[model samples]
Target: MDNRNMSDIIESYLKEILDQKNQIEIRRSEMADLFNCVPSQINYVINTRFTIHKGYKVESKRGGGGYIRILKINLLTSNDYLETMSEVIESDLTESEAHAILEQLYGNNLISAREFRLLVTIFDTKNLSTCEDLNKLRSQMMMGLLERLAYEELE
Candidate 1:
């Protein structure tokens, strides 16, 4: 709707499709009819936008029940995931939320029992029982610890 070129539109659509992990099966004639362009225009857009170099695989059938299938390549770099998790935990977390995140890290084999115990020691509320206003402080500290670990993992 913003007057983007055909390739941009196709690229955006492909991203959405990949996010949903749903295969696209558009008939060439139907696509051409919807876009009010020749079928070759659709071919050009598909070739340019859904290429393997851009992390996609495409297949097409040519008969009466023919359709196009696009598969997205999932690239999960460890450093990237770690960096992203570090950025995600920059905000405060509730105790239960922090425990859940810690569980996830444990389940993913990202941290050992000693590290988990250390984190629990660092975030335990027993040490702060003397303070009357430490409700969210534990959560903040836990988030800070996780963020630091994630950042360290990126290095």
Candidate 2:
């Protein structure tokens, strides 16, 4: 199987468990053995698929009896979620970072898929003039969009 498929399978499995438990702790070796993949593959999935931007907190210990813990953060309010997204934007926003934020917002039902796709297209910095500071521009644009959405939610 391709690495992407493996990552998707692992991510889905973890999300399923997390949905029930809200948190989970597991050993990397055990997950590797179960998936018939290298330990590093598990790390790859965890690092990319489960990130703070996606509303997950991951902690790990390294040793013979080490464990990796994944926690699903519950943002009780839209303001809290917006604050987290602001932190993710922190000073600059690359195309990929903007895409990640849109994906997270869409996944959390904060924005529609149509809105997500629109934002993704609009944030494409390649088409813009090289003289423009894409990172700073994108950061400002994303923050404006997110703030508008948050305000809409309140009203």
Candidate 3:
């Protein structure tokens, strides 16, 4: 029931797709041979993990020349948005600066309305203690969070 290996395989395959600029064409048989698994294993991984919920687009063909294409989904203008987010996190950001960045994502339709609200609420100034060093902590935390978001597990 754990299916850890299955999950790991799926994650690794997803990473390969992402690393190759979100474009890949591999035959099911070739992939199965490489993984030392059956073709259905490949199909199962694709069906479960490469879903839109996780921000990917998948297409496939059937016949003598069948292939699969996996595209990484970006919420439009994502590159520019990520660059700006990196800048804001790198520099000294006041409460207004943080708020503005979140607002921009909300306005651009990058983040859902609920997610935007939750993010704003979690990073609220009211939650921090007077003696706690918020600026330094926020900068460190932001970088770590960004790294986690940016890096994907390899297949």
Candidate 4:
């Protein structure tokens, strides 16, 4: 009895392929046929799951012989990735946004699993519910962590 939704299953299936390679190319119709789903369902999965902020680059070829290409992006230097992410972190952070940022860091190997879990705990909305200005506090805390990470990269 798997409670996972179709999108989760589809995303997991695609990620398994991505783990073996930096990129994957597949036909949309073929994917739908394999999964016993509609092409639009495939589109929805790709559109939401394979997003840029999630550190994925997606390109598609249209018309006959069309296919989708998903690439897991990598940076030559970790600092460059951190700098880009620093800019991406919003002034008022939401829990989902923080989770995405943390996941990106963990996925890129910039943060260890322990650090990721700790950060996730700290940034969880429930933990910050008592704060008067939760977003502001979370933003400042994340900025501090980002600065610490950047500084550690110098050593």
Candidate 5:
């Protein structure tokens, strides 16, 4: 299977388990064995899929008793979640980082499908090739777009 499929399977498995509990602790090697994949595959799934932007906090221990703990962060409100995301984007913004934020917002239902597509198109690196300072432009554009969307949601 492709890496994307493997990642999706791993992510789904973890999310399914997590649904039964607020937190889960698992050994990386054990999970790898269960999925018939390498330990790095588990790490890849955890790092990319279970990120802070996705409302997960991950902690790991090394050695014989090593375990990876995944905790779901519960944001009090949508505004609070948006505020937390805004803080995360504090200065510079990269293409991948911006895409992650957009994905998070869409996953949490904070943004609609149309909005997500529009934002994705606007922030696409290729679309912004005309800009001299890509990072700065991306940061400004994302910030402005987010602020406007937040305001619209408030109205």
Candidate 6:
């Protein structure tokens, strides 16, 4: 039996389609039916998995003929991704959000494994438990990393 849960299976299915093309239009009800799940489950997966920060753009339409459009944003080309990612970081960032950004960078080969590990270590809340505002610290570290990436390309 597969150990992965419903959400993982559904996400993989959608990504499989996305790999073939940059965009896909899906009906929530149909996706739920195909996966033997409820429509709300489909909504949950889309909302969480397909986010702008994670390199996906999602558009949803509600009602009888409603559909969800997912576009895999290909901003990974060139150093522009670093600049774009820098702009997206807010004043505060949760650990999960930080990991998402790091994972995206590593997956896109923008950062080497060593750099990825260094960032992950620096951003770990456990290492910064003495600080009252972990999120703010994380945001600063992320921005610093983005700046370093841009500077690295200049060398």
Which candidate leads the pack in lDDT? 6
- What is the TM-score (0 to 1) of candidate 6? 0.89
Q: For model 2, what is the C-alpha lDDT against the true structure? A: 0.85
User: In the order shown, what is each candidate's alpha-carbon RMSD?
Assistant: 14.6, 2.7, 14.2, 3.1, 3.1, 1.8
Task: Give candidate 6 regions above 4 Å deviation.
Answer: none
Worst 10 residues of 5 by lDDT: 73-82
The digit string of per-residue lDDT tens for model 1 on 22-97 reads 4566777887787777888888888866654334568999999998878764436434434444455534544554
Positional deviation of residue 65's Cα in model 6 after best superposition, in angstroms: 3.4
RMSD of 4: 3.1
Candidate of highest TM-score: 6
Point out where model 4 deviates above 4 Å.
1-3, 61-67, 107-109, 130-140
TM-score of each: 0.44, 0.79, 0.47, 0.73, 0.75, 0.89
Q: After best superposition, candidate 4 residue 153: deviation in angstroms?
A: 0.8
Of the candidates numbered 1 and 2, which has the greater lDDT value? Answer: 2
Per lDDT, what order, best first?
Answer: 6, 4, 2, 5, 3, 1
- Put down candidate 2 lDDT per residue, 1-155, tens digits, no spaces: 45568889999999999999889999999999999999999999999988876778899999998999999877687677887787667668878778888887888788888988888888888654573688888889888988888788789
- lDDT tens per residue, model 6, 1-155: 99999999999999999999999999988898899999999999998998866878898788988889999878745477787778889999888888888988898887889988988888888998999999998999889888988888778
Worst 10 residues of 1 by lDDT: 73-82
Model 2 lDDT-worst window of ten: 125-134
Which digits, one per residue and each the tens of the lDDT, describe model 3 over residues 104-130?
A: 557666567998888777556775447
- Model 4 lDDT per residue over 1-155, tens place: 99999999999999999989999999999999999999999999999888765877799989898889999877778787778767866778777767877898898788999999999999998999999988888888878888888999999
Q: If the candidates were sorted by their TM-score against the true structure, best first, what order would they fall in?
A: 6, 2, 5, 4, 3, 1
